[model samples]
Target: MRGIAAAGAYVPRFRLPAEELASAWGTSHASGIRRKAVPAVDEDALTMAVEAAERALSSDAVDRDELTLTAVATTTPPAEEGELLPRLVRALALPKSVETATVGGHTAAGAEALSRALDAEGPALVVVADCPEGDPAEGDHPLGAGAAAFVVDDDPSAPVTGTAWHTEETPGVRFRERGGEEVDSLGVTTYQRNAVREAVTDAVSSLPVDPADVDAAAVHQPDGRFPYRATADLPVSNEAVSAGTVVDRIGDAGAATVPLGLLAALDDADAALDGDAESDANAESDTDAESDADDAGDVENEPNGAGPSIAAFFGGGTAVAVAVEGGLAVEGIADLDGGATIDYVSYLRERGYVVDGEVAGGGAHVSLPNWRRSLDQRYRLVAGVCPECGSVSFPPEGACQSCRSRVEFTEFEAPRTGTVRALTVIGQGGAPPEFAELQQRDGAYAVAIVELDADAGRVRLPAQITDADPGDVAVGDEVRATVRRIYEQEGVPRYGVKFEPTA
Candidate 1:
């Protein structure tokens, strides 16, 4: 049985309330969404996908050797061409031999990617990440940013029982120019209603066996209410649909919606099976468990005995559906809170809709050395462990920085977390071109010197502060390193680690 062995999601730790948008524009868009997730100034589809993949791997001890295929789905890809999957594969520290592919250009591709993983004979990871773009006044209300990841295996965490899909060339419902922003049809509302309803109905009916066995259902939600409307006449019930409907909080995270909704349904199914009376606490516990497992390298195996769960996805002219059974417990996997709230102006700055000017700072124009050293500097955060002095070096070198010993050293995953030993906030006039947008969003931004504290040893590292207000940050604040886009050089995004305050 192939299905989701492990599931994880990334909801950017920042929210832009609809009210904030309304306040900014002086006109409300008439929507049920209170707020939507917003990626940090440094975050994009690639970094968010990496985080979600790490979380999924934490729930299941997927050996690197077992993973044969990797699929990534996103409408908002960080880069246009060479290789999207390799970046994620390296970020996950997977072996170089792993085969990979990119499925994109539509939201339905996410489900298609997951379905491909389910069909694979060996272990596979399917990831969907999107940071959607839209016009602030009109298109922004329904677009939210998030990512979801799933690991598929012969014996999955969530086993699959049945599946179906349907596709047709229905052009112009939604379209985007090459290397351009997406634009929906003026008739988008009506077009989506009919397309989603028809596609979901047909896909469900095509399942070989009876489809009514579904106990829970997850359908594509463009907004808070679309799933309810689309599945009204389907075999599933309101209660079943309610379990997976999360757009009320996160908004429509294109390419991530179906996977995230499915995760919510699985969590609900798991809670019901356990008769979990304290759902809120259990969810929090589950989140902690996953995070702890990832931090400590001791992932737990918690199984589920839930009944069938039906997931459906519909995008421009395409739809995919599947019925899964067994191993579907995913509490806390999708829980996201403790996020910093940003105003509408900050949201626009972060999304790059309002840029101050061309960012000046970037990686080395020559990329060979950086590319070769990625495993050490970017992926593993590898540092030297000197045998003689027992001191760790941030960048492993010929000699130990602490004792000046010329002894050989072993390399391992360095502590990517630490405390801010020194901090300074640069005002807009003093900010570099790379950070001018951030300074413009907020009057000032902080730069920190962090002292790393890990099992290996301590090392001081210079970093930028994110996801918090300048005045709120202090010298002793605890923070964790997160991968983020430093800047783009020659049309390529340069990624590095940045620190954010811990909640």
Candidate 2:
């Protein structure tokens, strides 16, 4: 049973409800159309891919060097060709000879990239990304941008038992004009559901295990309806669907949604294990709590054979379904699961995050006491009206470029809420030696600007999004800001801003 070894997920912070677009454009799509990821000016598909891949490697049990191949699946790129992999590989410090495969031309190329990984002569990193150009007048103007990645390993948590492909270069769900034009949507609803149902239904039915016995399912994160539509056509129930539905909340992330959704599910399962371990111990006299998770390492070598069977599915519209049975040998994967259990107290000590006060209950997201953590909504945001124009900036910068005048800015807590005004999928290039000099771990990260709701069109700058799928994001959806590390621009550890859904 070549089952799952580990999984990771990611999502952009900003969201704009499709309804908002519908209201603005006075069209049906504006009401509930698809959304895309919103990358900050500093980000690209390469950065977003790196972010997703890092999470996959970090949260899953895996190794860095074990990734011998990198298959980058994207629809857009700064350059059509030219060692793009090197830019990312250099950042993550991956192997020098790692084989690189770039698959573009279509959004569904994500699944194609995964297929490449499976066929790889060796272990590989599979990255899928999408960040359509943001065109205001176009219907897809609010395309959400995002990416998801996975380090291939025959691990137990996220095993890849057997993979099959069903592809057609024929006419797809939507097409565009000659060049740089808005997409032409035809039977959009019918197309989405039909494609998803055909692929998933065929794959599941042909597999050995029955749908009733499958504990979980991770399909494309295009919409909340995808799960219901795909599953209702099969034997699975509503409960069987996982909560990767960040689209309404965050706007659709182009490439990272499916992988992000899978990672989210894996995180959920790991958290559950932690809770059960704690609850069981608390009820007893003392937690015996092993006091040290490392101590049980040698013990874990012996098979417990007592966990549920999990399924993960990713790729563009109507991608193939994958099923991994229990029991498989994946080496690099176990290391990632080790990360999910890291104690907040220990993590802080290791990273040396700012200690403002007593951090007892909350994890790193919390502040010591009155002060905030390195990454927090309050710290990442501050309201300051332009000295010259009187226009406000959510993050409150020193100089007001608007009026070019320094006003006696009164301090006001910035609103954490916002929507995705625009986004793009891009790559990181030309970095100073400090950030660029170091061995790069991953290539991409998801970044976005959140349009503050209270401030009308004001933005919170950039923020890292979590627990979301790029496809699940939509324009006009409600969102809130959070402080997080987008990635290290240089060894200096660049502080960043990101958004997530209010719900």
Candidate 3:
């Protein structure tokens, strides 16, 4: 009965229109796609995973103390050689004793992570994140970025009814070299179509329920057109498949595609069931006795028809099928509407493909040991409260800033949502060498001293303002903190909290 107790997703606020991409390369837009989600310059697979994981955990379906394992799947990790699970674990504030695992190098890794979580001994969190890159000139412009997370446990409300998997050697469909950044394809349309069809058919056929009876189907989509063509022969209807399709707006999110699509289907099913329940309640409350009797009889005869059942299909070189019986929609799923659109050159700059000249040896550098010691303050916004004066000091300075108290200060976690107390705009060429690249990618940004209300007192901390223009931000604006890449030092991406205007 292990199933998804809760689920969450993250789609970046920045989008690149397909027409803009086509204009840059002077080609037709990728077939059946309007726009693709693009991660901000400070975002990557790890950061996006953190965003999704936090949303999933906020549901409180699985308590943090009860979580025993954390598994992450991603094709585009921040670094190939380092351990990413620790960072995720720290960001989520999970127990230090929790087990961790990283899965990647293939697009099917997301399904593998979910399977492991279902089979594990205790409750586990499965996170899938990817920022896929493809050369536009090579006809691979649909690759995009996104993340999704699920909490798996023995929850019967959303039971996992059946599961199956299929794998085969299908080379040259899509792959990357050992040290390559871009995913390469051989344009083997016939070969790719055959592989997707065979894998999906075999996997779906193994499910316990009849395929035609499935209320919804979520299939891996490398593009908008593939899912429909692959599921054409299946017993499921086109409307059922279309309920889970998301690539038309978000593009190909690699490991995150199927999971994101499944979430969408589950949300739709939950909404429908809720609407039906409300209607039934209203009919019973009305003055009509015959309608009540009819509804009662229908419920008695259809005891098994509580909620929509969903079929999920994952495919890369490997394919997995999972049947889900019921669902409870997770809150805070990223809204895909109204993202800021950027032109092609700005997109290139954000992706690091086109950088203005590099400046060497400028910004302040912190040693690994120092950075490690301050993770709690940076990631969780932990502050220190003065025992005598009750003043809060951010970064937990040993002494009280108000009364100069020598006594040990109490630790406190500052609120993430706050008000801007002061602000300044840093124009181009005025940034330190460390921020030179960021300044180049995003011209003229704002810095704000935000005041966060803590239990003991107010704490003011200086941080860079993101997702807003320098000219637009003001002293009274409301903002929220989110983890993002600050800069890279010694081959590592440093992460810190940045403030964005509250939606």
Model 1: per-residue Cα lDDT over 1-503, one tens digit each: 77777777788887887788888888755266667888876788999998888777776447756788889999888766755787788778887888787898888888878877876778898889997777667777668878888888877646677778888766666666787775454555776687778888888777654545454567888777787778866766565565566666677788887777777666533334444423432343253343233225421112221246678888878877887764454534544433567788878877767776555665235475665575456656778899998989877877789899887778887776789999998876787765555566545778899887778788777778877777899999999887777655556676767788885
lDDT of each: 0.72, 0.49, 0.77
lDDT preference between candidates 2 and 3, better one: 3
> What ranges in model 2 sit over 4 Å off?
1-7, 17-23, 27-37, 59-61, 134-138, 168-170, 176-183, 242-244, 269-318, 325-503
Best by lDDT: 3
Pitting candidate 1 against candidate 2, the one with the higher lDDT is 1
- Residue pairs in clash, model 1: 4-158, 5-157
Give one digit per residue, the lDDT tens place, for model 3 in 363-383. Answer: 688998999899997889988
lDDT of 2 by residue, 375-424 (tens): 23333355667656777755455566466565666545565567776554
Ranking by TM-score: 3, 1, 2
Q: Using lDDT as the measure, what is the rank order of every candidate, best first?
A: 3, 1, 2
Q: What is the lDDT of residue 138 in candidate 1?
A: 76
